[model samples]
Target chain A: MSTRTVDLVDYDDAVRRYDPVLGIEVHVELGTVTKMFCGAEVEFGGEPNTQVTPVSLGLPGALPVVNRTAVESAIKIGLALNCSIAESCRFARKNYFYPDNPKNFQTSQYDEPIAFDGYLDVELEDGTVFRVEIERAHMEEDAGKNTHVGGAGGRISGAEYSLVDYNRAGIPLVEIVTRPIEGVGERAPEIARAYVKTLRDIFRALDVSEARMERGNVRADVNLSLRATPESPLGTRTETKNVNSFRSVERAVRYEVSRQAALLDAGDAVVQETRHWHEDRGVTSSGRVKSDAEDYRYFPEPDLVPVAPARSWVESLRAAQPELPVERRRRLQGEWGYADAEMRDVVNADAIDIIEATVAAGSSPAGARKWWMGELARRAKSAEVELAELPVTPGQVAQLQGLVDSGRINDKLARQALEGVLAGEGDPEQVVVARGLEVVSDDGPLLEAIDAALAAQPDIAEKIRSGNLGPVGAIIGAVMKATRGQADAGRVRELVIERTSA
Target chain B: MSTISRDEVARVAALARIDLRPDELDRLAGELDVIVDSVAQVSAVATPDVPATSHPLPMTNVYREDVPVPALPVADVLAAAPDAQDGRFAVPQILGEE
Candidate 1:
């Protein structure tokens, strides 16, 4: 538990000295109705130990059968990643002892995976496309949930006992492993985050998993190793286990790089081990060593036969694939006519869906982007919620933009109407009517305000009468203030010039 | 020929969570060597042309539809456990030492 002794070099200094190599393994829980091998119901937050079958419980004489949809989901994930599907694959038993795994062994794939040899190109913050090659994606079952009682912070260490819930056990999971990503000098951390985000988007696009990082549906195990230089041999690596969020994935890589660099500087070898990420403290601590001693003797499971997906079936799945998230982004960017940086900002903010819906609700692309990225984004940040989770809807935003486009209100008044909508004052139109926030379009009242401004500011109006229009703005400002900012400045200027010239 | 060592036998024993005496490890090492020697005879007869087999019957793609089936009753599920608590299975503390 003591990470105090681990010295860390400065991040920039470490990157300047060492080259980082990263390999990521992501596990996504598929949203199937049943478990991977049994017919037990799969639902989140169910009563403990209730969703279990004899096969899941590893009862004697109970046979296991594979769920068909889980395999299809795995295949879809592979196809989306542009991987070649294996003609045949089998499940192998990974033997271990844990309370979470009721079966003493976890049935996973070894040597033969369902999908392999794929690649995903993720765009970084600056729109630099970094291609991460996919090694394979395999199917496995999840372990049970373990609650450590009488421990400090529910940690496994110093616990008096532990409770196991088998409801989560045996749920279908697709584990995607990336090949060794090399030659990423300083953008290693950003690439790590972007890669995971891309995968999350891909999973949701495929409709296989919920792909929500908050719900533990997607988890990443980040493996980092540092070499002296680009041409040097790979250094001893550390695997950070179960980093559940994108920011944490990026942070874990950065921390490990600095920690390993300090170790090398002091002439100490970086121990190859599984490190646990502490989200609160923003550091990683050593967990267990993965030496040659700890071995999971893997062997094929005899209970289940080989899954030889026919060529025709694979072609059908490939044909039924949806347009991937990356391709969809390109199409949307073209349609919206936004520049590279603008599109990148919209994608990074996760505002693409909302902006699309706002566009569908009859707002122009620039109008939708303006309200969401400028005003709504700031509000969401201050309120500590997601932009989509804000009180205002896409329809309401479009309506507010419509009011601005039709000359009924300026941008300032539109913001006030948005504030009213957020305050639960009803829709944009309702808020506009209730607050009387519409622009003073009637020339009768505008002429009155302009005449009053000209009478009050005679010297400034006198300059406009002498053909010096520089004083026209002063009269317009006065009229806008008199109308409580509901009067349009352009319309006020036109009317002020007419009254002063006459 | 003795192919299995005493240390190897002890390692397998510990993995299976079996506490064996020193004398038993020594005796089992010799006995396991004979078992291996007998199993090695089958490999000698297996030609390169013959492929490996995981199951006897030739079958593939054995699957079940993604349908819900009633799980075993919680009481019945807990009945088989040595200790149960609060609708969960309770066990001694695990330090995650490998």
Candidate 2:
């Protein structure tokens, strides 16, 4: 690896000089029950090497048979992405000497993919619809996990040794490759992030995979190159691999654009190579260099036959496709009467499901959104947790909203009750009852508090009695303070006016 | 005409992680040339009318149910490895991807 540090051009300056073209390849592991080619169970966090079969272990004389469910999942994903299903596809051997794969070759699709030629329209943060064209989505098998021992940074290099676990081997993977996405200009990073997030939502909607980035269920390989202008030829690009998060995908693209711009500004050429994304350092380091030795020399796998999905089956899968994220977002926005910006904010916060649940639990759409996008969202941010990870549930939020709508608790009292709920006190109702957060409904207690406030501030009371109603706010404030902010200010105002008139 | 060169054979051997002598590299290049020529003859007969076949059988979509079978015991699995550590297969340090 080259240790020379290069200066970076500012992102604005880089975009001013060049146009960035992006090609993203996203890999999603299918949530199948078994290995793609064997009967070994597909699971996470199992004993090391315990989930392997003879086929997964690449033992001699053992053969592999395709898993029906895995193929069905691949078809479902393809249909959701609007890709045309291939009538027949076959696997090929991608030969390498890596110990991650015990077979010394990975079984993957080549030349013939299961799905190809589709496009997805992704909604950016500002609600701009950008269509990302799909090239192909192919089926492949995952490799084993290698834990580098005695290594700095836990990379394969400089490690004393490595331990290999075959538990993840043979898990089914569907790699979706996007065609060269041009004309995005400066929005390349935003489009890249949005595209991956849209696919993740689609995968979950299709129920093909868990689609969790933290669990490595979905990973992105971001390929980016900058041209002199939109009309210029494509420049040499770098492939940054395993950018697992949406934010990381965007960051990797921007970093590459800036880094490449600096190289061009210095009159140096960009090298085409594979680079690894370091999430902590927010920079990409060079991985394997491009060379003849990197060639896979792909050939058809003689052990497995072709997969010819019937036309009827493809149509059936297409018909069974669920409402994808884009359609669902549009539907929800219309049904909730939310403006586009409001809906985008909710989606950005990842609170759509919880808000829907709150509405289903009998809260108004506006009310549910107000709590989730307002108080709860603020609380989640402050607590450094996900909106879903907040201790308060949708039902409790709806209950709190119910209390507010019924005038049993004012907004202030509702906020206190919500705090109690997040603190694990109890449900909203129990929290309100336990914390005595109910608004003052009986006029007798209000009368006593009002009398006490007027007696203490007789001059202000006189001013209110002489027809200056402004000082009546003083009485209400005193009463509210005396009542621990649980009394409704509107009702307090009415009671104070009556007392002053009498 | 030589179908495979000694350097090409050396590169393939390196990719396969095989230690090849110079003389062995030259000898294998000659042997691989014969194999390549024989394979080319088969391709020569394969015209557009005859669809290329990856498998000998005419069948397609051979699949098994997704029900899982139990895995082997850890001791049995580790027994097949040349070296084992921490219930995993241990190997020498990889020279790439830091």
Candidate 3:
């Protein structure tokens, strides 16, 4: 397919003319202890070939045995999305030739998936509920990761050679495919992002996979098409493969809409193929032409048998789902007394979990929100790092707030202590001690400094004794300067007033 | 009569990434006929009385416990590979990302 060929119609114009159909396919690796079809364990990155068994390597005599935990996780995901679990389903072999897939064929479900016909009610930032239909969530095995070495980075395009890590090979994955979502006119990009983010939250709540989008634990393939009218035939769709992050998912949908509209506006047929999401360029490039090579001669796998989950098993898994992200957000928003905008801010910052932990560690909800949303967030942004990856933990932040609450440190010193704690000076208390940041609560040292300040500023002290406290700042400033800004100013003022009046 | 042609076998061999000489290609063409016929014969044995079967044995949910067994030694896994570097299976340039 030609990319950036003609000037694309603007986003507003495109949506006004054509209806966008969004189809999302999310593949999540089940964090099971063992590989799907082998005795080998499933680890993310080990010595490259160490995690593979003969079965994973697709050796001559090795056979596969399914991992029960993977099947259970798939069913649980289906139930959370409000899907009907299949009573009986068998594995099918998807035949293709890829070097990463040592088996040369992937063991997946074709027509007979284990779960189907589900719907996920996704709530956007503005609380707009969009119900996305689920086509199926099928069980499959992942291919090995290809790391091409001997170039700038480990990219396969210009690399001298590639490395294969079979640690990921044969790992169980649940591919959740969504039906063609329609009726979302201009909110198409927002809907795509919200749906994927909701699904990630559900996965984490279920404890299925780690569901880290940046790490490729949960990957999405976005299929987008445009039609002239809502009733017209669907236009040729392009599948953008493995858009990694939530933000990228939204950008991919928006980019494809403009690109495809441009192609159609120029009287060019959008070639039906897969494209690559270039995160650096914020554009898509044509990867390969989709042809009969996609005809993956699917047939039932002979090495394995049919899986018919007991009704009781499916029910038990469904019952085990924890409170999903949306429900938790609703509850937390109420408990924390947050307005809609305030709650949206916390969710967008992705600090809901950290804020909850901080509150649990003894900081007030408002206090926790203030510290996290103000100081820590600014630090994270300035350093170009994620908030979760920041060195300070919720408990450390709670300790910092505790010092301020207990009068051991004033708000001014507390800010410096927080910086010291993040810089690895130890906890808040340790940072306070290391940096000598405690509030000067002892009035003896403060009275001595205040008496000296009064002796030096007799005129201002007399003016303060006459009940005009405006000149109290003169004595307080003198004491503050003498103590190098460590002494508490309010206590100095109190001593100055007592001495001057006597 | 074999419906498969010599050119078809060459294309299949190419996809499979095996380089074959002209004489070898001609010999492989006749071998494809035998393999196809054998597979067809297996399908022909299914009658109205018999049901479609995926495996010779009837087994479902044959799974391992959620416990990790040590992976094979690094040397053995690398031995299977044509090349290895820093305990990884290294290969030539890959043309496609998918």
Candidate 2 chain A, poorest ten consecutive residues by summed lDDT: A288-297
Q: Write the per-residue lDDT of candidate 1 for residues A280-357, one digit (tens) a residue.
A: 988998988873524677888999999999999989999999989888999999999999989989988989989999
Winner by TM-score: 2
Model 2: per-residue lDDT, tens digit, A312-356? 988888888888888888899999999988888898888898999
DockQ of 2: 0.81
Better of 1 and 3 by lDDT: 1
Model 2 segments more than 4 A misplaced: A291-294
TM-score for model 3?
Answer: 0.89
* TM-score, chain A, candidate 1: 0.91
What value does the lDDT take at residue A134 in candidate 1? 98
- Candidates 1 and 2, the one with greater TM-score: 2
Model 3: TM-score, first chain: 0.93
What lDDT does each candidate get? Answer: 0.92, 0.91, 0.86
TM-score of chain A of each: 0.91, 0.94, 0.93
- Badly placed stretches (over 4 Å) of model 3 are A1-6, A149-161, A291-294, A433-436, A481-499, B1-52
Query: Model 3, B20: alpha-carbon shift in Å?
Result: 11
* Docking quality band of candidate 1, CAPRI definitions: medium
Report backbone clashes per prediction.
0, 0, 0
Worst 10 residues of 1 chain A by lDDT: A289-298
- The candidate with the higher lDDT, 2 or 3, is 2
**Residue-level lDDT tens digits of model 1 in B4-96:** 999999998987778999999999999999999988999999999998888787999999999999999999999988898899999899895
Across residues A83-136, which tens digit of lDDT does each residue of candidate 3 receive? 999998999998887778988899999878999999999998878898999999
